[model samples]
Target: MNNYFNSNSVYIEEDFRCRFRMRRYVFERLLHDVQQVNPYFRQKLDRAGRPGFSPHQKVTVALRMMAYGSPADSMDETHGMSESTCLDTLQQFCDTIFQVHKDEYLRKPNQEDLNRLIRKAEDRGFPGMIGSLDCMHWDWKNCPNGWQGGFSGRSRKPTVVLEAVASYDTWIWHAFFGVLGSQNDITVLGRLPFFNNLMEGKAPQLHYYIKNRQYNMGYYLADDIYPKWATLVQAIPNPRNDTEKLFTLH
Candidate 1:
């Protein structure tokens, strides 16, 4: 911990971010928040009266395990923590983090959020666009043998898919993960639970105009792989005219 958090720390802030995946202040804030609710994160004494792991030590190990997908045993030597202890710390850390930040960071978009997203999209020439929808593949290094074939797609390797919707500012309003890689974008879209809100009439109402024609529903910009749906807009495959080409630019 002294190598980074001490007053005379050795490494610089850049090094901390490169290793921890967040700025030092951000990490400190997380540590503070986690400690506030979970006493397990606080430094304590063992039966022998020796000081146990400090808050920074525990939080750092947990972050390393998450950020780099490092195994629990890998931290036994570097951070002087046992494998069992590391696992427990990671679980507690994750639970505490979600408890602290879920309300703001993990929530679905509300009416006000929709308004802000629409205004930003309108400024960029897409008045009715809520966000861009996309999918990405994350390699599954430890996929079970029974499920490997089902998860392996064109990459010929076991993987999982993550679908996300993000506004112009890169604020992710929706995320759906854990779909098998074998599924294409269309298949993934069909399995998305996010549409349940829309189907149930629970989604926020939207109002916007394009060429003086008002639209009540918001749409997402997607790639050609997606089906042609009113809620999804795709660029022209072959833009023959300047107007079509300019429209594609947006």
Candidate 2:
């Protein structure tokens, strides 16, 4: 393998950080953690007298794959690795990251988290709001042949639906993925863990006021497609006038 990550290369450290969305120190720390858990990331000389790619190069390629969502073949020249190896390395990298950090990073909000969210939402006019509920479709370029009809709806291309709840600061509180595009938002919601949490009485309590009226339940802002439940607040459809419409939209 050819190594492209040179310590004294002309590539500015700041430029590399900008491309990966993380500082050099942070990236190195992440690389260290991943390397500690997995030995494959460490460069080695194989029996055939061929050397593997360095850890820094492999990590940079994986990060670029995630940041750009580019095809595996496009990454070969960037780090001088084969296309198939690049894809395999990316898969392994993601799996290792999940194994190492899923508990702390992907966990549901705790009591302290809920309190902070409540305070943040209170400043934004919606007193008891914690986050927004939404669903987005991601195009599945390599969907298997047997699953074409099941995954493709109006898109004419296979897609996977992701239902997520996120706070205003872009922090995700909940996420459910791998749903077929044919399924509606309501169907996805029914299948996700959020509903399970609500049904199991694991949801946190919230207290706030609107126009002197008090509300104790926490709610999420949602689109009109969702139901009119006390826990969900949808945008007003067919506002009476421009002012009301502006308010509803904003």
Candidate 3:
């Protein structure tokens, strides 16, 4: 029988060495942030008789495997660990890393960040645009049987939702991921922490630049999918006539 479905012969290719090293570099950058929040990581590494690899090595290998979608056998072959050991280490690393960096990694933009962004947008004559919001779907390859039912919708495939906010220059300001694909754009937006800030006056004020004149408050830009909010300014649909198109062009 072919070994493709079997785990024994699974192995990483030699050509992937460069890829592995690059992944390790990315993981190292996140390690500082991870160590600050997760006490379990410190405790586990400090404990004696820990059969797995070093905490740093385990985290690096696991994160690389996840981020690159490498198989368990590939990780075992690359990192010189057994397949079962690689699996265990990956599970352990994910649990600890997520717990430690959950808040810091997932936090919404604060007032200061929003203020600076608004100022930058104003400098470019695109005032009142806090951020350009958009969503994308991440294809999921191995969703659990039970989860497949909930994860698939009209797309008929398992997918995770990702929403991002970007500036006029297309630099991402904030991003949230892992929402189920069944969710609509408005449903996802409603759950964003930034929305709460807007409602609670915690977000920075909206500024408008017209005719070298500056006006404060009263507008924001979002896709038409978002319901009208006191602070939101929705773009007009179609821009019906030429005059309307001219107004919409800016």
Candidate 4:
């Protein structure tokens, strides 16, 4: 008990919270959630008959590593786990979180979800708009030799693109990660699974009214680089009028 609890506050877990960068309650809740789905997260006795680290500690170290983008060895002081073990813990934690929440969290919109999105978007004066589509890059520190040149054209750094469609509330409805950085945004969009889902008629139907004009389809807010399409809404370039400026501003 003394080992896990701080000497100053036995009940509050002040030291734990400080090290984990989360409230004690949230840490415990995350541990409970993961324990239900992953056996690897469960605490166990070692082969030497010594008690191993608890599930919360493993998750805390992994979350800290990911949240801070720090190396595994950085957690040795607080987590007391070996660098190799920290990497394994992080891998297991990510896989378990995805397996448990993928159905509800990462899945595409359903009818009810679509309705909620439509309501939220309409309330923001953009009726029938689902989300903003954009691409972000993540640096690849260990990119392969053959791929490095291709991925490092402009930035001179190897990166992988992640395209996502995210709403005002930050709910991501579409995600296509791991596209090569060599491809432009248009090529990335063309090769993404989001378009394949649309082509296969797997996307949910959308209906909304814009300026009292009824529409049967929804659209996404994209930047100028995206191609002209029925489902894409781009801002007017160099607006010289109040209406166009206001439209672009909002």
C-alpha lDDT score of every prediction, in listed order: 0.85, 0.80, 0.64, 0.79
TM-score leaderboard ranking: 1, 4, 2, 3
- TM-score against truth, every candidate: 0.88, 0.77, 0.58, 0.81
| Between candidates 1 and 3, the TM-score winner | 1
Worst 10 residues of 3 by lDDT: 1-10
Candidate 3 residue lDDT tens string, 18-51: 5455433445555665566554344353256665
Pairs of residues clashing in candidate 2: none
Clashes of each: 0, 0, 0, 0
TM-score of 2: 0.77
Superposed by TM-score, candidate 4 places the C-alpha of residue 159 at a distance from the truth, in angstroms, of 1.2
lDDT of 4: 0.79
Order of quality (lDDT): 1, 2, 4, 3
Residue-level error in angstroms, candidate 3, position 46: 14
Which digits, one per residue and each the tens of the lDDT, describe model 2 over residues 96-202? 99988887669888878889989988887678888899989888889899988888767688888888899988888688884654455777777775676654543
198: Cα error in model 1, Å: 6.2
Indicate whether candidate 2 or candidate 3 has the larger lDDT.
2
The alpha-carbon deviation from the true structure for residue 247 of candidate 1, after best TM-score superposition, in angstroms, is 4.3
